[model samples]
Target: MSRRSLLRGFSGLGTAGALAALTGCGVPAAYVEAGDRSAADRSARDKSLVFANWPLYIDTDDKNTSKRPTLDAFSKRSGISVKYTEEINDNDEFFGKISPALMNHQETGRDLIVISDWMAARFVRLGWVQEMDRAKQPNVAKYLDPQLSSPAFDKGRLHSVPWQSGITGIAYNKKRLGREIKHTSELWEPSLKGKVTLLSGLDEAFALLMQGDGVDITRWTADDFHRMCDQVEKYVKNKQIRRFTGNDYIKDLSTGDVLACQAYSGDVIQLQADNPDIEFVVPEEGAELWAESMMIPNLARHKSNAEKLIDYYYEPEVAAELAAWVNYVCPVPAAREVLASSKDKDTAELAEDPLIFPDDAMRKRLAIARDITSGERVEFAKRWNAIVGL
Candidate 1:
């Protein structure tokens, strides 16, 4: 089904029913904007596209680490100098850095930026980003993942494009667990006490936890949230969870400090290369599908150039190059063919990896969570922080 229709289906639910449904389920509800689309100032000169992304996200030439051949080729072919910068270390910190600029009607010194969708929702809600002109991006409209087209955050192609996708699943060191864990409930079993970890970031963590109780995350309600909170309180009281973390969860899982913990499919792919014993599971209940999306910030001086750069990456060859290096979920449907053609057995094998292509079996177990809106942030953070003692 089209993403819009799927989300619209849930719009019919009453608030309480939705919450009750979401309590312990993994599916996230659809987000509908409560107001009109924010208008953008369209009269601006265009040339260079300044891009802000997370560290190590793009494909770099192996021998020449400084060069991103795919992006460089785009610059040469399209005559667009991409002023790409790696400045997004933490979500909140990056938000703080750019909030003043966005609030004061100044340029964010970036034409495009990549951020997690939950954070992307905040920008979209506040009208901090420019609406993309899809006519200029036929590649995106044609090739982008249909499931991600109308996210709970951006109902239409009004704001962002998913740069890559991943799942929040259970990752465990099989050697440490001495048994395979196939579901979320396994983490809560007494044997795993103090041997598991959760993501500290509220957005990064919650949906999967909610899933353990069988709460349908798509239509989760306040009561469901509270119940999940209460359960986490118990885990905290017993010190069953080692601590909440970010990428550090990889470190703990690798060193055997954590037997099983919430993990991103992309990171686990890389982690497995170093330690084959590390395994990822989409718990029987369900898992959250998340992505870091690319958007044009408001008041960018190079909108056309930026659009060109984005379209370049949409090409299957370019997308495959990126998918090969970064090891995240590939958004371009056609890239799977490119990966399969690779003479390198490792690259060809990646084409068969469910984490990358996400076979129907894995897709069935995945859902995107409800994004915390600007108004909801403070209250959500407060409640979540109390649980993690952040």
Candidate 2:
């Protein structure tokens, strides 16, 4: 399956049934206390940690697909063997797989895992993950992006660390369109009717559209959400929106079937390499900055080793190397200089790609939207999903 498909599959616990279980009636019994969220540390004796993440998320060796350079470097330097598994294909599915172990106060048999921040919020809320010892993660303290330093769900990042960050922005075929798209309102112009698309997932789609209406996403209200939906519903009925899509938006943009669409920054970078006509724009109004984050699950045996691994990836040099391969916004700002000094021409040019290391002006326009709260999830999702036809 494509990485985008895995990134967004099934809207991960957003269905009505799942929402009911998570926030319906009284507080659920699955909540773990801070005191019970840990197990005895075994890093000194084990010298190993198991990591579970999405497929194709990390940087791999060009010559050997099986080898991950940054991970290998960490293993070589720390002498800590990593048992990495690409076992998390969908958030809700993975949650069902491990929640039993977590809620039961038993070991999950894995030390570290990565999941989107929305789902990470669920883990943090239920106290299913442990906090990192910042004293042991100096590199992360020094190099992590300020914009991602704190989120509403994980204030000051007590329980999670971002793996890679991306932008939910507008992408257009500039050459074919014969003009620039500087604002989100431009999508509604009659010239582009029936030639636009939006993301299908509620969590994936709402923020940017809300931003288009000049709403401050960091603290947007329920009324702002309903207004955005009303506008989309009108467009949908008039055929102004060609369709709602997932990662398949790439094909539509590439073939000129869709002039513009909601797109992810990393995917647009890959598309631009093959077709320079494709241009990604963080609109004048604004855009949503999002991340898939890393967390150490409760009862992990190699907690110390996992903390070391997390810090190692924060080193600018290691971050730059991974940024070159993954093409997402680097969560470590200082890595830009490391990439700028690269001996390889392609590697060096990546330093200036705003998508990878967004410049000052762009930074001002990007905001991490506050996540959909548990109280709001069921009602908001029902209305949003209904319009998207999910």
Candidate 3:
């Protein structure tokens, strides 16, 4: 899954309606007052920024435990002290923690955060995050992938910016299967009965399965969703699927407990290094091209500092360095060239990997799944959880 994190649910209700009345729970109006920060207000803020992100996401050195050179360099050059914290473990958990603060119009104590685009869309819709000033992010304005610029959720480059990207595709043990897997339907093949796994998380699992049925992910319908669920029900009854999982699917595939499973492109990159037999396939049906985006929370104290830090990473050379260690899809197209000129052979070779800089062939097979709307979340989560038995 692209780690597209967001929550959705039914609109007309009693509990939800009461909550809605208290905090205007439905999607908030798009940035009318949200984007009105002046240059003076931005400049008068502190030179420090607080960033909240997921764990095990950035590059770290094995030898020197205290130093994050990239971050350190940014601080040195820009005089911005970045207090980076890996406080996000799960989407729903983090939302529960911060929503109360946002509901009361209080600061969430975070200047910036990196979250899956699906979840980012919720913050964008709820007006919990502020619109970024692209003028301060000159490199970002120039280098952000055109494909990610205007998601259906956020119609412009106004609310969020992609931090890194990945694809939701197939990862299988080539040696165990003795054949390459190329399509989503192949997971249900008779020979592979009880040898496959799907993600249990609704936000992470839904779109790729939908695409298996040849559904257009950009505009998938309820009928499309139901059809996929029906197929899953049949698979469950036939015992063709072992079980659903989160990141544990990686361990299952590695230990040979399962021969095949749905996988994130970024995870496959790391797994392939340790076990060369593990192969990632871009299925013929299509895959979700997703990103964990960066956004500024509303009433943040260091908005300008956060914008500057965002642009620093946008520099192609800087982006390439981070991509080399992280191994996710690089959203900056220009970074490919920067990577190609690397002093290290291993780094330069990353420029040639189709997964990182997807070629025309692979690009044609990727789609950004339409985000599940807030009105659809509750019922959808309920049905999806029941299917996965979560």
Give the C-alpha miss distance for residue 18 in model 1, angstroms.
31
Clashing residue pairs found in predicted model 2: none
The predicted structure with the larger lDDT, 1 or 3, is 3
Give all TM-scores, in the order shown: 0.87, 0.95, 0.91
RMSD of each: 8.7, 2.1, 4.1
Number of the top-ranking candidate, with TM-score as the measure: 2
Task: Report lDDT (Cα) of residue 12, candidate 2.
Answer: 36
- Note the Cα lDDT for every prediction shown: 0.76, 0.89, 0.80
Q: What TM-score would you give candidate 3 relative to the actual structure?
A: 0.91
lDDT of 1 at 372: 59
Which of the numbered candidates is closest to the native, going by highest lDDT? 2
- Cα lDDT tens digits, model 1, 146-244, are 767788778885789888888888899998789999888788889999998887767777899888889887777777778888888888899988887
At residue 187, candidate 1 shows an lDDT of 82
lDDT of 2 by residue, 182-284 (tens): 9999999999999999988788888999999999999999999999999999999999999998778988999999999999999999999999999999999
lDDT (tens digit, per residue) of candidate 3 on 97-196:
6776665567788888987788888887777888888888999989998888888888876978888999988899999999989899899999999999
Which 10 residues in a row give candidate 2 its minimum summed lDDT? 9-18
